[model samples]
Target: MTEALRLPAEKIHAAELEALKADDKERRPPGWALSPRAAVTYLMGGKAANGMPISAKYVGDKRLIETAVATLATDRALLLLGVPGTAKSWVSEHLAAAVSGDSTMVIQCTAGTDENQVRYGWNYAQLLAHGPSRQALVPTPLFRAMEAGKLCRLEELTRMGSDVQDTLITVLSEKMMPIPELNESVYAVRGFNVIATANNRDKGVNELSSALKRRFNVVVLPLPDDMEQEIAIVTKRVGEMAQSLDLPAPKNVSEEVARVVAIFRELRGGATMDGKITLKTPSGTLSTAEAIAVMIGGLSQAAFFNGGKLSAEGLAPNMIGAIVKDPVQDKVVLEEYLETVLKKRPDYADYYHMLSDLT
Candidate 1:
């Protein structure tokens, strides 16, 4: 296969999956790659029975992962709900990879998505030549997953229109998709399930119907519980992404990463770390993911423009962009934060001046 700009979890962790499967002595659920116990271990990271080190993909509560895995072991589908940058989609991809050994079967839901894209579409020329036959049918990722007993991912589920979102009602509840045109129905094989993600902060999201919501085992993924956790996530992801994109590895940025995470945590919490003062939160989520982006941006700026030295002045532009979503409201929020919070800290006086100059 050609080199991809990014690899799915399955591709990146194929060896770990193999090791887990090899040592999986427990009874496997119908078509799972690893047993529930081993799958959890694969996610949480540990040495398999064969002594292969499985790296941790997620950095959160172990019980939440157990609940998510246990949900897939049953008949119900899994719904990962969270605000942006909470790793809902990341966890979903890894779960599918660990459970089914294939994470490529994905349908990215969007506002423009239609029923045909979710279910199936017809090949124009082939349809004209052969009419409604299987040969001319273009099976979607969901249809193929159902036929193959694999996991199918639906990303940004709430971004799609209500009518298009409801197309899965029958598929989730009945585990079958009817094809009246071909006079045949596609029944989901055992182990076939859907994993979907939706950002809670999305505006005007098409809310899932009560009936549709009932079909899923909902798992709400919260943001990193503390600063250290968020910092670790950002550092690991930034290193991996920089390597993948062939960007220069930043030097001595751990303190910067901690500072970035601290800023986001404070803004998100709407108070200083001591909780003595309140802050007006910005329109932006200020998620850990965005912090990583800011870090990477600073690294790039340093690498090409500043003689490979990462500095607070170099990060100011990216930090400003990440924090300021609304020109008027968010700017005021950030300005107040700079004056009330950053300006008061002796250690952050340089960052305050740098950011103030840019704004």
Candidate 2:
């Protein structure tokens, strides 16, 4: 059988979950796959009781993950708020996988999403034939999750219309979905809850209602604390992504990864690493996630076009594409950054020249 292009978190990290489960001795909340402490270990990475190493899924603060897990153990839902590419969705997937043993229960909220998508819908044929009987009901991810006592994820929650988004208020507040037509309701079983993510930097997002906000325990996922931390994240993610893509490892991968991360960090912070130079921040997020994409794109470029040799020439175009979201304004930002900062560094001479030639 052909391999799947991408596996859910539970399948991708099945071994770690199994190892954690084998060693978990803590008291488990009803319907949870792993205990609260064990779930945290699976996320933050640690050695199990039998000494099996569990790889860290999220590289940020342990406290945040702990808080998220603790919230799920209660009646409140978890809302992971962060700027674009802060791993909001990534963390949500892993958390749901660890807590519920399945990450497929997800609703990708968008501007077009409606009540039918969130709460439930009807099988038209069955409804027409059977006159709104139980068999005519079409369960959505949220509805199914409630029925099975599993965690359901809502991605990009703010993208949905305020009215459609409000549909969640009742389900979240009462832990039940009412079907007035059938005079029935679906009450949440133990261990059922929601994990939602929203991009704080996005424009035109519908703000969450105060009533809806009260139903969740919001946790903000912040960007990497420093250059070293950001570089590590980019490097690790790039390596994993490259392997998945079946691309050959490029030469001096670490050096190239560091260069990409430094450029993003400088542009994002609006200053040089040494604090000696002030710079203009671009309209784009220039997030760590984009840095990972840049490196992966560079690796693919080297593997296919440059005979598996990573160079500033291979990385420059991808870097420009990531940083220059707004064609006219961001171009000026990049040019100034190249000349003022990258040009001054003797080590970045190749990057400055390549980027200048491309832009």
Candidate 3:
């Protein structure tokens, strides 16, 4: 239980996945971790009949998780599109682990990624010295997953060059990749599939050719819609992190969590909760996930430096550190918000004073 945000998928709950398998009355393709329905449960959270705990990984919408799971269950591939911090890659990791038992099958799509990364690359020395053979072929994770009938994740899919991304078109629709140099082609097994995530902010972004899009059933993840849900996401994540890291337990904290989420939701939506105040928002995406991280960081600091009592003095500086992404305008915006919304709140004035002192 390191503090690192990304955990290897195999380290995820094995019992939960097993419960999913037992709950899976549906037919399964060979070598899958669970049936599609069970995969959805593990993603969205549900109980095992045996009373084992299945943690909720995705907190936004049950339907979206279902769509992604169903897409993979069918012959079609799955694509998750959203802004940063929306848990696109997290869901991808959990889904691959729950469905295929191997979350290591992955490719991090980037501007410089080439066909060698998505397909196969040659061992140049072996190619020149030993002639073309198995020893000269280095398979991409996708290629390995294809042969093994497992799920492969492509992160930041649109970030890759379109040509590099296009290699996936044949890999998905045709379920095969050709190696002319080797006079051979690799065809995927029955349960093989892809789970990809792309940034919606990156839309109009190197647009995935429609041909490529056709290969996937697209699921657009959304930011948490209301303040309470956002708070819940932040609170839950912070609590989990505290326990895993052995940080002194956070208390008197939900109020701060609520305030952080409320501020983020109001600013991101350009309006107040009662729809009374219309405020200007900055360019940074104030997502619930970020709020959770900020709280966890602040709490950890308080635990080590102070007496582990989560105080306004401990958290406000960190919140300011997280929100004021742009130095000039964002600073002004945050200052104004503090003066108007948080200045007069009865129990939260201490946080206001702390924030004023910091920023």
Candidate 4:
């Protein structure tokens, strides 16, 4: 298997859900592998009664996970609102997998997304020959999802043009897509649903219409709350990412990774871990996902440079490089964090030393 062909999500183990379903004692909805509670557990990571473990997918809020799972049970669509790296797409994938046993139905929304792309499109060459036959129609993921009554994901929904986003209104509320050219129409089957992810940081984006907004059950995913949770998330993600990339297993970087994630979470929350100090965050959101990438990059650096042991020597410099994207402002913010919070910590002498070596 060549490295470039692999995706991290492919390495993400989903058999855990299947196992839970096999042993599930709860009531399951029609076409659902596990009940809503079991699906939530699969996403949020929980201990089963039989000691079967489910890996956490989203790594954000528990309530948000519940709300997402709940929305799928109802007629309303689901909207996962958050900044980048909130695992909005990950949650959507797992929900689809547990609900329908498939996650391939998706329309990746972008600035260029248009109506025909969402609803249906004609094979232009076939259209020129056949001229508006059903054979010429190109069914999008949204179309198939409606026909089969499965979850269809719309990623980066806010990046889509306002007009393109509105293409969802009728399909959502009316649950019907009409094709005037073919003189045909299709109604959604039972269990049909949509999951859309939007970033809050993309302010002034092509905003959704009130009519469309009414159709979705919106749940905002938040950053990890504290050090332990953040570390746990980064550790799991980095391990999974390393395996997926076919990179050698990273070792002994947990404290460094923990330190980096702690910094990001602190800056994100506008306060120190102890809540004793407050600091201004930079423009960068410093998502948990990014922290995993940072550590993986650092590990790669260590492996390539120093025989695969992650020395403080290689880790600190790359850690600084990852966090300090904006030299002037982020540098000042980082220096402040080091001076006030990190420098005085008795337990983390090397962490403070790493920060000091940068200056």
Best by lDDT: 2
Error of 1 at 112 (Å): 1.3
State residue 215's C-alpha deviation in candidate 1, in Å.
0.1
Candidate 3's error at 3, in angstroms? Answer: 12
The sequence of per-residue lDDT tens digits that candidate 3 reaches over residues 1-359 is: 65766567657587788776776778776768787777877888888767787899889889888888878888899999888889998899998988888899999988888999999999999999998887899999999999999999999999888888888988998889898888999999878999999987754457889999988899998998767788888888888888888886756678778877776787788877888777888667877778888788778878888887787777777778777888899888888877887786777688788888878
For model 1, name the residue pairs that clash. none
The model with the greater lDDT, 1 or 2, is 2
Cα lDDT, model 4, residue 225: 63
Candidate 3 vs. true structure, TM-score = 0.93
Per-residue lDDT of candidate 1, residues 1-359 (tens digit): 88877788888988999989986899889988889999899889999888889888888899999999999988788999988988888899999999999999999998899999999999989999979899999999999999999999999999999999999999998999999999999999888999999888979789998888998999999988788889998988888777887778767788888887888889888999999999999998888779999999988898889988888878889999989888999889988999999999988877889989887
Whose TM-score is greatest here? 2
Which parts of model 2 have CA positions greater than 4 angstroms off? Answer: none
TM-scores for every candidate against the unseen true structure: 0.97, 0.98, 0.93, 0.88
Q: What 10-residue stretch in candidate 2 is worst by lDDT?
A: 248-257
Greater lDDT among 2 and 4 belongs to 2
Question: What's the C-alpha lDDT at position 207 in model 2?
Answer: 94
Q: Which ten residues in a row have the lowest lDDT in candidate 3?
A: 1-10
State the C-alpha lDDT per candidate.
0.90, 0.92, 0.84, 0.80
Flag clash pairs in model 4.
none
lDDT-based ranking, best first? Answer: 2, 1, 3, 4
